[model samples]
Target: MPAPSPLRAALLAARANLAPGLVLQGFAAAIVAGYYLAPPVRTALERLAVFRGEVGLPFAVVSTGIFGAVIPFVILRLSAATRNRYTLAQMSALVAFWAYKGVEISLFYALQARVFGEEQTVFTIVAKTLVDQFVYGPTLAAPLTWLVYAWVELRFDTRALIADLRAPGLYRERIFPLLVTSWSVWLPTVVIIYLLPTALQLPLQNIVCCFFTLLIIFMTRRPTGAV
Candidate 1:
């Protein structure tokens, strides 16, 4: 049998990811529904903004690191093999990667909010979602995160990481698929995130990020042969 092409492998990966993607989307959808239909949830989400304002960028960096990296690692902590590979250095890298992402997304969302204004109109939401999923995400967010995570996967081995990048069509083999999966999952979720008040945007992003981190960790746990 011919080996899987990059696109094919990516599709299979995305298919395999549907369960976690759906779960994350459902969680985000529930949050959106709650914000619209439940007063308590709205209040709680708003409070996150208040806290974010108090701490500035550190709020996002710390929250993203915790929800995105720390918690997922803890979930798989029971596996001795898993625990063995990831020590302080690996953990720190993961934290720093996630923290950077948190900072990026927070600033991105804030900029979008400023550009698009804090209106809840359909046009406003659509504009931000379009730029988020199609523009900023594909161009910057997805590819960058995939590369950073790839380094983490190789335990931060610089030479090995360079070889992987130097492989023919790294974009097709790795990044394109990641972007495909990210668009598949985050497209709708980004819309839900943009539908909220400015202060709550980063907070909601962090919440959805929690599930996303869990999904990524789940994927990484799969057998190398299976992937």
Candidate 2:
């Protein structure tokens, strides 16, 4: 049999790259459940780890265990689907999501300070913003991160970055896959947020979360003229 055309190979590689994003999206979903469902848990986290308060260490342990238990399985699933070895790809995907979350978190904190005054810290404000901005923001962000990397790979392969930006949309022919790819990661995340205790069910807040996640993705890939 004849070898696959270079175009076919390149497209396959692009699709493979999206796997990392998908995996990280699942991780982002789980984190939303962990940090948001329990108020005391979030407070304990702020006190012990990121900032200092009177929260106990065991709360951290329990919370981490409760939410983090799913991580291994998620990693396993994503790894099984991808061409890249599981560990490296999972790490890379997570790292991408983390970086994306960092930006959104910083924005959230800044806004929190503005609206609530600096006197109030994030733990004190038990609103929907906590999970939407910090947790789920990274769902879309992870995919955007991988897409940027994929774009870079195209550049290295001597394809114009501008040209490759159009590639994601070229598969408009495959709308279901694109929709499936995006929502498969997003809808489960929203569901987890809804099902867990202390879920922020405000309509406006949910809308904003949806908007921001898409906005982040757009900004990341828009420069390249891709969706």
Candidate 3:
């Protein structure tokens, strides 16, 4: 068989790392959103499985399963080369990280509720608003976080990532081409996550929170070529 193109290999590795983390982060956001919705998707999942009564596991599982499947499918559809060297071991590690987040989020909310009681009153609302301005501000920064992570990852693994950037004949390696190829799919999805509230008449805060969780994935992932 012909050897796998270096660009293809690099991109696949990047995607594989990003994909699972994104799904997990997305799942965390979903749990927060489900809190406001009538359905309570998170609690439902907790009730059904090992995650029973757990805070974020249910939502995490649902979000990860759905987005995890969809993003990879979209990537495969867009680039046949994405289906390269994506090992099961890597996928398992991704899922494990996701589960850790689920547990963490659950513990946090649980602790807050137990210590402070439910946050449905006016005073609590005001306090949360104040916290939002400082302590929780990073949670609102999703787009910037993802972009920075992608850039850093690319730089760290520049050699491995763009090994094929130079062909025997081609002299210049245009970064824009590589970026556009990857972001063509990711950018739209990011935009859609933010836009869902406005388009679907859902709560904007929830959408924002969901995107924030997605951002965390990008922030926390172990950069392959940590520059």
Candidate 4:
């Protein structure tokens, strides 16, 4: 039998992981709902005092690092093989997430205050969604994610990384398919996120990052034939 095409393979893989995907989506929904309904959570986060002014940039970095990378690493440890240690790849991912969150938060502010010049309005929300989905997300965020994960999987080998860049069909077979899958998840999530107050965006993103990281781990760890 012929092997599945990259897009087909990705579709099958996504279908296989539908259960976890749905669970994560539900969790994301709950977070959005809770953020709106539960005043105390927002109040306490605001009271942190660390998230004020220029401090917020560093706060976002630390918070995202903890939720996106550190917590996931701890969970990975529960498995015997991944216990008691972290690989260089994991460390790389942690650093990448920390840096990305910093930039992400900055861009969020720019989009709200500079580009759209408003918050939670129909025009601003739609503009943010379009820019994110079409421009920044595809060009910057997705490629950075792909490169970081690729670097880790390549064992930080510069030569291999260079070769992979020269590899034929790599973009078609891997990068494009993952981009499609990523947008399927993140685009709508960002729409909901943009609706929230500026102060709440990063914290909520950090919360979502935890579940999203778990979902990635779940999807990636599944057996080849599981799809």
Structural similarity to truth (TM-score) of each candidate: 0.88, 0.34, 0.35, 0.80
Clashing pairs in 3: 46-52
Top candidate by lDDT: 1
Q: Model 2 residue 17 lDDT?
A: 40
Model 3 per-residue lDDT tens digits across residues 49-84: 333434335555444433433343344446565453
The numbered model that scores best in TM-score is 1
| Positional deviation of residue 222's Cα in model 1 after best superposition, in angstroms | 10
Q: What is the lDDT of residue 157 in candidate 2?
A: 40
**Global lDDT scores for all candidate models:** 0.78, 0.40, 0.40, 0.67
**Tens-digit per-residue lDDT, 1-227, candidate 2:** 88554445434534554565455545555555555676775565344343312333333333332222224324344654422323444344434443444445345544544554443233434443444434544454444544554453343343565555556653332222333344434444444443322212222123223333332232223233443
Local distance difference test, candidate 3: 0.40
True-vs-predicted CA distance for residue 50, candidate 3, Å:
13
Q: What TM-score would candidate 1 get against the native?
A: 0.88
Task: Quote the lDDT for 138 in model 1.
Answer: 75
How would you encode candidate 1's per-residue C-alpha lDDT over 1-227 as one tens digit per residue?
Answer: 99787778767877887887788778878888898899999788777778879999998899889887887678657777666646778778888898988899888988998998889999999999999988997789877877777777777779978988888998877778777767767888888888778777777777667766655554444246431
Better of 3 and 4 by lDDT: 4
Candidate 1: 10-residue stretch with minimal lDDT: 218-227
